[model samples]
Target: MNAPSSLALAVPALSLKDIGKHFDGLEALRGISLDVAKGEIVALLGTSGCGKSTLLNIVSGLLPADRGELRIDGQPAASFRDWRRIAYMFQEDRLLPWRSIRANVAFGLEAERSRRAERIVKAEQALRLVELDGFARAWPHQLSGGMRSRVALARSLVVEPQILLMDEPFSKLDPQTRAQMHQELLRLQRFKNITVVFVTHDVEEAVVLADRVVVLEPRPGRIRAIKPLDLPRPRIPTDLAVSEQVRQLRMAL
Candidate 1:
């Protein structure tokens, strides 16, 4: 695993400086600045319309920032040079009804027929990583909600992007499924050592999955506070200490 440098100001896997955004003369985000290091899982926590999704869109290049800059591994957004360096998992699965699971996972490699075979192999591995290997031939509608989310995750992982941006991907699932999926995510993160920027409205979810949780204020959004969770890995979500800390973090927000 790549370790973060000792310096606090060291170049991050993803960085945003003085980022701002607006819609129809209304400011959505204001001067937002943040840095996420490689192999780190950082959560953006806030209430509805807090610009969390907007900030995520800006980073993913889905929406342009009105001001400031975004950098991935010290390079500007325009300097990405390779589209494969970033993978996005939106709230919706967005899978094509016509495509099978394997095809959907290997969608990005469609143009390369020769490489398509290799991509399908990799896609199967990704599905296995998410415990959905047998569902490769299934249609999107055939799967459950949790299974659909896993498919979305597999699609993102198939690209092997250096930076993964997820926007409330598990918010709609039931509590039990959400907890189970959280464990799956942590396992995958450890196995892949991927850098993740997870956006969530659920404070407990942030506390559970994040190495560091950043709170954003609404109405021209800006970061309010950042809290570090120095807890040991493979943590049981029901642990008393974890629960206490999560409660404290929620109160602090």
Candidate 2:
């Protein structure tokens, strides 16, 4: 595997070989194969209803594929396993109205009371990671859309998952906020060395953030094309090199 950095050289975190999924009579995915190295950020780019989210769900164990094999660090997907190594952030913030931001972020850590103090420290550190430190006491309803998204990100990171599955987490934000969050996510992913498999309908966003951009064909989705993006980062959206690459990718779509 050609990892961008040495930190990404661990065993494959997640792998899907000939994975297929069907919902009732509708086939959602067909024979999809991919691998996410320890710290790679892979983007699945396609139009709406392309089965990217379904594939993500299967990998996350929220859903089961009807055919083929899925594995986590070489273990078969169907085996009883520790799923704590994977974290998911959906399009919606999914914050708890009853819990404060700090409490919500710390929710996952509650089971291990033997290290409550350390968990609290980790929660605060995660909040800081998403630049939401001072808002720890804020309620979910009080935050702006972007801030709420940050809180969601903090919640995911607090668990220190080896892999993150993000499903258009910033799609609801305004354009400006989305751009800012993109840069922030790049920084966070770099610092944490977490493998990320993100589903986005935006071609430009995929071009900017992915080490490889994969497009799935419509209904009964299957991998249509896999394009490697060798661009240097931090990517500037308006920069000629980046813009041209994005245009070409969109054209291919």
Best by lDDT: 2
lDDT of candidate 2 over 68-121, digit per residue (tens): 999897789878377876889999999999999998898867755548678778
Whole-model lDDT, model 1: 0.86
Q: Candidate 1: which stretches are off by over 4 Å?
A: 1-10, 111-114
Q: State the lDDT of candidate 1 residue by residue for 11-64, as single tens digits.
A: 688989999999999999998988888889999999998899999999988788
Q: Which stretches of candidate 2 lie over 4 Å from their true place?
A: 1-10, 111-115
TM-score of 1: 0.92
Model 2, residue 122: C-alpha shift (Å) = 1.7
Q: Pick the candidate with the highest TM-score.
A: 2
Worst 10 residues of 1 by lDDT: 1-10
lDDT of 1 at 119: 87
lDDT at residue 162 of model 2 (Cα atoms): 83
Cα lDDT computed for each candidate against the true fold: 0.86, 0.87
